[model samples]
Target chain A: MNLYEYEAKRIFEAGGIPVPPAVRITKPEELAKVHFGYPLTLKCQVMSGGRGKAGGIKFAKDLEEGKALAKDLLQLVIKGSKTESLLVEPMVSIAKELYLAVTLDRERGCPIFIASAEGGIEIESSHNVLTEPIPFPYHPYVGRNLAAKLGLKGAVMAKVADLANKLYKVFESKDLDLAEINPLVITKGDDVLALDGKIIINDDSIGRQPAFKGWMEAHLVDMSPRERRAKMTDLNLVELDGNIGILCNGAGLTMATMDMVKAFGGQPGNFLDAGGGSDQKKTLAALELVNENPAVDVILLNILGGITACDEVAGALVEFMKKYPERQMVVRLRGNNQDVAEKMLAASGLKLYPDLEEAVKEAVSRSKNATKKPALAAKA
Target chain B: MILVDKHTKVVVQGATGKMGAAHTKRMLDYGTNIVAGVTPGKGGEKIHNVPVFDTVMEAVKTTGATCSVIFVPPYLALDAGYEALDAGISLLVLITEGIPPQDTAKLAAAVKAKGAKLIGPNCPGIITPGQSLIGILPGSIFKSGPVGMVSKSGTLTYEIALALTESGYGQSTCVGTGGDPIKGLDYQEVLSMFEHDPATEVIVMIGEIGGNAEEEAAAFIKKNVKKPVIGYIAGQTAPPGKRMGHAGAIISGGKGTAESKLEAFKANGVRVAMTPGEVAKQVAEAIKQPAKA
Candidate 1:
């Protein structure tokens, strides 16, 4: 899960990395207690990057200025993400701005450190960057080696090297995909500070990290209720803007189905993977998630069951059809127990498509047809 | 030659569970010699008439089984994999999903260090058609032929294999390399084996949007492979930065894009198929012609 800057800063501070002291303000009125005061940088807390260019940052010289900045930033939106709060910090003078990050290099199947003498948004394209692969347990000399490559020496060099060592410890311990301190600033006095922080915890490792589990709970508070329910149900769901709801068994098949829906000129309302071996209850939950979306006129369920039995899913479809008779379903069930599934669907006065293309095209046309009819209220 | 034939002895981990027992029966029906089962605290029991043991070392000692397919829950996957590896099971097929990447990283390194190979920590197992069936793939979709297949996906493996079968082009061996970020065997490693194996004539690579696996494979084929390679990439429609069901399918930092992978394949002289059906047709056509340099 991606962490907002303020959240990431908390992790950085706890890890012994130096960051500018900051206070979090959810509203303009909350700024009264922030006594560090004057000429503070008010950074809107949004998940997406390029927050500065997107007008999510402002400066304030006094209490009234800070309050006004907070109010404006709390109402601002960066990219597609709205501001949840503001991080208020006393602006600092910088002698030099550098960048560094410890992230998993998927190709190498290990973690790597990326550092640059020049920091900021353009650091990604900077030729001055140095990358070094880190072995497990993080050998200490690797940090010193990276700092040496950055062309630094003396006390400042030692500090940068020490910071790199500590940063990687957090990366490994937190099970993070990335722990980045972009624009890590060097003061005139040679003190280093992480001006911006970005961290992404590995979602699959949430069970092992107690602190992140709490973060995930707070993370869900901003999501739509349907999305929250999907999370609790173990359904891999993404809300897409469209009219046709698509459900499939495996990750690859689900994506392939979504591509097919788009190929046939039908927009998919959502992408939901029921996963392999989904039984009756999970199948019914998946169907209800899509069927309840009032914008979704048709749900196209494509199950190429290998572990998931075709007949079991067909039974769920029959039960769901009984409850929501008005909803349209385009079903293509195949693989294990397909013959029994075919017969089961036929007995319920429903039909199954034999081919993927035919089923997708039929759903697209049915969705187009349904747009002419009034959208019924989702069953309360 | 195919990796495993009828005589290769196999043991099922977590064999007393519902999935392990069901697939064990399916594999047994396909004539795979599943000699023993392993489930902690379930020793002395039998699944599908196969004897069960509590520890992997005990099972290996008794049956001399060199291969193990795991079905343990996600949290216990690391322990299960290590147990099998320590017990001298050289080939490990991890069938559980949702294994934390950290555990997988540790497992991947351990497997490498031991000079053994792990197929997946979150993937469907491998299969050689009509000879031996392992993991959750439907054996009916495959038939023995000159084509060797490797894919990052499970169902896409079945979908394309079915298409190949329907078109009268069967497979010599098909391996679902697993969609996770780090797999035991990648496209390049599998391609080398297929290139050397006499049974495989044409190669089909199924890749998705994420990672440099496809690009790396294409580079390998351009240099080392003499066999005709046909590539099919999924997720042309997937939005960037959004996590698809597969964790590895996310595109970030201007990397792992479908267009970039497709371009790499084309630049390296690998044949690209836009859709699943096209993959089968291209493979059939490639086989009719002689092998390319």
Candidate 2:
């Protein structure tokens, strides 16, 4: 789960890292009571990057300006995500900016610290970035090593190293997948402040972190309706703008099925992984999710039942088709009681294909035909 | 050579859980030599006639079990794994998913230190067809033969295995390397074992989007593996940065793309298949060809 700037800054403060004092405003009227000082930065809270480029951040020199900007930002939708709240903080005067972060290096299977002399918008293109792998329970001296690598010295250097160590401590203790302080600013007085912060908690570690469990509940409030419904059903559903709805078992096979649908000239409306060993209830939930989508013209069920028995899947499809007799479905069930599943489907006036290619081709053709019939009738 | 067979004595960790009990029955049904089971409080109870012990050490001491299949939940997987390692179990097949990456990294390091083999933390485990089963893969779809298989997926592996079985090619051993960023064994490591195994003449490698494991395996196959190798990659249509269900199945920083992996395989003299059926066809064709000089 990605944390808002305000939340991440709160964590940073708890970890003894210096951050600019900030207040969160959920309503525009709340901005009137804000007394952080003049020259405040109003940052729109959304779970996306490039908020500044998208006009989600505005600089207000006074209270009146801050209120107006907060109102505008609250109403703004950036990158398909609505701005739910704003982080109001006193803008800092920076003598210099640097970047620092800690994230898992998946290839090496370890945590690594990334640092760069250049920070802010152009950090991605900066050539001065350096990375150092940190062992578990990392040594405090490694922070100074990274600080020195970024060309820091004196009291400011010590402060930056101390901040780095604290950030790492927070990252490990919180089970965060990533903890980043972009544009760690050095004020004119040589005091370093984390200007902006971002942290992503590892989803698998959510069970162990109660605070993050609460954060996940808040995170779900921002999801699309379909996504929320899928979450309730424990289904992995990603909504897309297309016509054919795909239902399959396993992540890899689900993706492969979507590719096959696209290859066969059909647009996939959603990606749904029914997961392994899904019973009739989960299968029905999956079907209901796809059926709820108005854009879905045809539902395709592609399951290679290894741990999942085909007969159980067949039973669920039978139940769903019996209730929604008008909905079109194309299924290819294989492995583990496939013969029984095939027999069950055959008796129900539904056709089951043995090959995935055949099932995909049939579903694509059926969807094309279903769309054309209405258009032709309207023309006639 | 793949670390499991009929003679390999087995013990089950977290044997009282739903997954452990279910797959234990299936493994035993397939004639696996399951000698004992271990559940913390359910000691002395028998699951499917296999004696239960409180700890892995006790189970190993009693049954002389060489391998352990872990079915503990994610939070406890590392501890369970450590117990198995401490008991001197030679091979550990972790069937549990959702283990934290940090825990897995620590577990991998410990496994290396103990000179033990760890199959998966989110994987389907290893299966030597018609001999022994250490994971939850459906046994009906596989048959013992000259083909050796390794995959990063559960159902996709079954799909390819079914395709191979239907195409008259059976498997010597099939290993699911688990779909996590960090896992016990990579494709290269599993491929190395298959390369030297006298039973495995043809190798079928299944990979998905994410990680450079396939590229590394392709390099290994190019230089060291003389067996006919056929490969298939899933998630060709997966959008970048999307999790795609699996925790490790995301394309990050313009790397670990299915197209890139396929291109790497083609460059390394490994036949790449676009789909599961195509994989079986390529493997069959590879089998018909004479040995490379």
Candidate 3:
């Protein structure tokens, strides 16, 4: 989960790190009230890297210019993610830009800090420094010594070390995947300030990070009905802007179904797993979860039986369709007790194919025909 | 009868529980000599005629079971694996999930140091058809034949096995290495095993999006594999950077994309199958073709 710049700055403030006074502006009325003087940097709130190179950021010299810049950035789309809000802050006159980030070093099985003297650009110049693996329980003495060795001294080195220590704490406690205070600026007055911030929290850590979770909940927008239902059921669901809605057991099958869908020339709307236990109610819930979405042109049920019996899933399908007669579904059921499930499906007037290729092709054809006919009378 | 011989003694950790008992029954039914069982508090108990010990060392001491199958919970999955490695167990199969990533790194390191191999923490375990069934995969789908199968997804093994059997090709051994993001045995490890196995003339490798495990396996195959290898990567259509099933099945910043995997396999001269049925058919055909030098 990527935190907005303002959110990341709030975390920095909590850690006692110095950041320029910033305001997250959304509405036009809030934009008018910006009391910051000329020479301000307005950055669009986005999750991707290379936002600076993109036109999503602008610098303005006056209030009128700032408002116009904010309006332009607010409407901009950076890396397919729209800029719904903007982070406004006064520009700092920097002597040099330094890069500092703490992320999980997968190879070392621990947290690591990557500090570089060259920053503010995507690609640092030749002779840019990237530190060796610095383990956690981050010692401020070690940080200060390293900075001094890198030619930074006096209060500048001490302040940078202090910030590094605090950042490490946040990185560990928050289970952040990536935390970057790019351009930890050395101002002319020798004060350190974070000019740009990026914080990517671990997805699994959402359970522990209540503040981040609350912020995400507050910023809820563009959630599909299937997403809402899956959220209610505590299922992981992502509605891709596609045609086929896939419901399968296990992640492997979910992935295979998505691939098979595409191989057959169909796009997958979302990936839905019924998990290990595929009971009647659970299967019905999964079907209803996908069926509730108007965007889903067809629902594909791919289940490979083991502990999850095929007959139980087949029974659930009958019950669900009987309750909702207008639903269209294609099922590819195999593995344990699959024979009985096939028999059941045949009785229900739905042809069951043992081959996934045939099943996917049929679903795609049905979805294509259903999409082509705009009028199931268009009347009512 | 396959992958393992009759002399390969097996141990089951957490054997007093339901899953352990079930797998024990299936393994026994498949003709494996179930040598010992281990449960922390349920020592001295006999489940399915196998003596249950309080520790893995005790089980190895009493029964000489060289391999261990672990059915412990997620929290203890890594520790259970480490226990097997420390006890000098050559092969360990873990069927648990939610094991911390750090723990996996530790287990992988421990296993490497001890010259031991671990199968899975959230995997379905390995099976040598007609010899032993250590995991939760159903026994009915398998038969003794030439195709050696390895997959990240547990149930996909069943799907591919069924497809092969229906196409008149039986498997020599099938292993589901699990679909967890941080896993033990990857496609490269299993492919090496299949490459040397006398019974395995052809290989079917199934992978999902995420990591370079599949691509890594392809490079290994190109350099070392003696048998023909056919590949099918799941989640070809999965949204980039969005985890499909396994936590690791994500395409991030140009890596682990399905097209990249497909291209890698093609470059390695491995037949790429777009679906499970095609995968089985391709493996059968490759086995019959003369190996290209």
Candidate 4:
């Protein structure tokens, strides 16, 4: 899960990293009492990147300017995410910007620390970046090594190395998937300050890190209502702009189904994985989600039941199809009580294909036919 | 001939849980020689007539089991793995998913140090057609034949195996190496074993969007594996940064794309299949051709 910049900076501060003092304003009206002084930065709190280019960040020279910027930012919608809060902080005058981060290197099966002397906006494409693999216990000397590799020396090198060690400690202690400080700036006073921060807590480690539970809850408030509903039902649903809705039993299968849909010249409207071992309620919930979308001309259910039984899915579909007669559906059910599911679907006036290709082809053609007729009728 | 066969003795960890009991019963019914079970405090109990022990060491000592399949929760998976390793199990299969990558890193290092083979902490385990079933894969889909299979998905593996069996290309063995960022065994390791197995002829590898495991396997095949290999990668249309069901199925920073993995396979002379049915067709065609000199 991605943390807001304020949350990430809080963790950085707890890890002994230097950060500019900041206050969170949930409402534009709350900016009236702000006393952090002039020349402050107001940043909209959203989960997406490129906030600066999206006009989510602004500067204020006085209280009136700060309030005006806060009002505008709080009402801004950048990249489909609205700003729910604004981070107010004193602006820093930077002598230079440097990039520092630690992330899991899956290829090497270990964590790696990345640093670069050139930082800020273009740091992602910078050629001066250096990466160092860290093993268990995170050797103390590794930070100094990274500092030296970034072409640092003297007191600056010592301070950078010390800051790197502290960042590593926070990364390890918080069970983070990623801990990044983009533009770790060197101030005019020659002191280092983490200008911006990003932390991704590993989803599986959430149970162990109880302190992050509240933060995660707050993060959920930022998600779309449909996403939150899907979360409550334990379904993986990602909405898209297409005409066909896909429901599958596993993640790989769901994606493969989407690929097949696209291959057959049909656009997939959403990705909904009912998960293995889903019952009637979960299946109904998934169907309801897809049915609610008017853009979905057809719903395709591709289930390769291993732990999940075909009969359970068929039972749910039969009930759902009966209630929603206008909705078109094409199902391919196989494995684990396949005969029973086929019999049940047949009795419900529904056809179940044993072949996935045939089912996908049928769904795509049916969706095209259904969509074409409406346009022809309107023209006539 | 690879990791498990009909005569291999299997032990179950976390045997008292729902998944453990269900798959254990299925494995035993499929002719696997399940000798014992381990559930920490449930030592004196017997599940499906298989004796249970307090620890992996006790189970190993009492039953002389050489292999263990774990079904514990994710948080306890590392401990269960360590117990199985300390008890000297030569081959360990972890059926539990959601194990933290950090824990997997530690467990993998220890497994290497002990000179033992670890299959998966989030995998479906291994199956030798018509002989032994050590994981949670559906046993009815498999048939004894010449095709050797390895995949990173559980249900997708079943789907592919089913397609192959229906198309008359039965499998010698099928292994799901789990879908996590860090896994115990990789495609290269399993591919090498399939290369030397006498009963296996063609190989079918199912990969998805994540990591460089498939690329590494392609490199290994180009140099060492002489057998004709059919490859299929899922998630061709998956967007970047979204974990599509599996924790390890995300494409990050323009790497681990399905297009890249498939291209790597094609460059290495491996036949690439767009669908599972296509995979079966390619395998059948490869089997009909005579071995290259």
Separately for all candidates shown, the number of backbone clashes (residues 3 or more apart, or on different chains) is 0, 0, 2, 0
- iRMSD (1 decimal) for each model: 1.4, 1.4, 3.1, 1.4
Which has the better TM-score: candidate 1, or candidate 3? 1
Q: After superposition, how far is residue B258 of candidate 1 from its true place, in Å?
A: 2.5
> What is the TM-score of each predicted model, taking all chains together?
0.94, 0.94, 0.81, 0.93
DockQ for model 2? 0.66
Computed on alpha carbons, the lDDT of every model, listed in order, comes to 0.86, 0.87, 0.77, 0.86
User: How far out, in Å, is residue B261 in model 2?
Assistant: 1.5
**lDDT tens string, model 3, A9-107?**
888888888999887898545666677776888889876667878887788888788877777788888777778698888888888888888876543
Instruction: Report the lDDT tens digits of candidate 3 across residue range B1-293.
Output: 23355678888987878767877887787777789999998899998888899899989988888889888776577678878877879988887655655456557667777887778767887778777777778878888789998898887777888888878888888888877666667777788888888888888898888777788888889999978888898887777766565667788777789899999999998888988778876876786793832
Residue A337 CA error for candidate 2 (Å)? 3.9
For candidate 1, write residues A89-125 as lDDT tens digits. Answer: 9988999999999987789887789999998756666
- The deviation in Å at residue B242 for candidate 3 is 3.0
Error of 3 at B73 (Å): 4.1
The 10 consecutive residues of candidate 3 chain A with the worst lDDT sum are A371-380
Runs of candidate 3 exceeding 4 Å displacement? A9-93, A102-116, A123-173, A186-194, A205-225, A228-242, A265-270, A339-347, A368-380, B1-66, B73-76, B79-90, B100-102
B-chain TM-scores per prediction: 0.98, 0.98, 0.95, 0.98
